[model samples]
Target: MKLPNPFRKREYQILTPATKVDDSILERPEFLPEEEVKRSGKKTAAKQKKGKQLEGLISYLRKPRAEEGYTVLIAACIAILFTVFAFFGMIQAAGEPSLTVSAAVMSAMLVSAYGIYLAVRALRDKEKDQLYTWVGLSLSSLVMVTWVIALLLGLTT
Candidate 1:
């Protein structure tokens, strides 16, 4: 009879001894110690610097024909505002076409039309960024569509 040795490796299996690890490698580094800590606002300074950089970039992007952009922005604001007001007015009136509701809707349509015109003008400017211009145009177009639908419904009823 053959006796098997406990430390002998089997033919179909392989094993390796574990290697020693350094304490430095095993331990995680700690945060800044209390003695080394200071009252410097480094994080705030970095955030402010980043904010200034973003502001500068935005100003640079908006450098061309700024007035047209402003107009488009104003018109878009007015259109959207009046459109919402008119919608609420209509709802309050219970679908009744009151003069105030009609006026609000008309104003919304006019402002949206103006916004579209300003957007088109901005688009024609060779150096304009056109980001706000496109946004204004889309918003105005949406208001205009909404007004038209309201008008059509009013006419039908």
Candidate 2:
């Protein structure tokens, strides 16, 4: 029995090269020319030591990627911790100078400053994403400004 086909055939064409290609273009040579190999021999001890010395710094700088960098993320987290400390100090205030609260506020300030530093560093890195960096910087700046205003008001009274 003859049946009607529901789908039509899709037309396509296959292509072939007119001439043979060079094998060298397709494969890597076992040995390169002297001029092509800039550093043919093993690295000297001094160069190896220098590389080892800079390894830590290089890795730290390399953490910045196409996505948000780790330093900026860490800065944001630190700023959040500063906010927590600030709120805790405010809530636990005894209306008098408390050593623990004073310490907390100071520590929070220092940590937030460090967070701002990290954010600035991350922002300076051209390879890193700046969204988190800006967030961290703004939050830290806001908290610092508020703290300064509060301190001023306290001194005025």
lDDT of 2 by residue, 56-115 (tens): 874544444524345555655665676676667667774664676677667667766776
Model 1 TM-score relative to the real fold: 0.56
lDDT of 1 by residue, 21-137 (tens): 323432212333433333444445556767988876645534565457777877888998898888798789897758987798889899999999888877877765667788788
- Candidate 1 wrong stretches, greater than 4 Å: 1-65
Candidate 1 collision pairs = none
TM-score of each: 0.56, 0.49
Global lDDT of model 2: 0.63
What's the lDDT for all of these models? 0.75, 0.63
Candidate 1, lDDT over the whole model: 0.75
Using TM-score as the measure, which candidate wins?
1
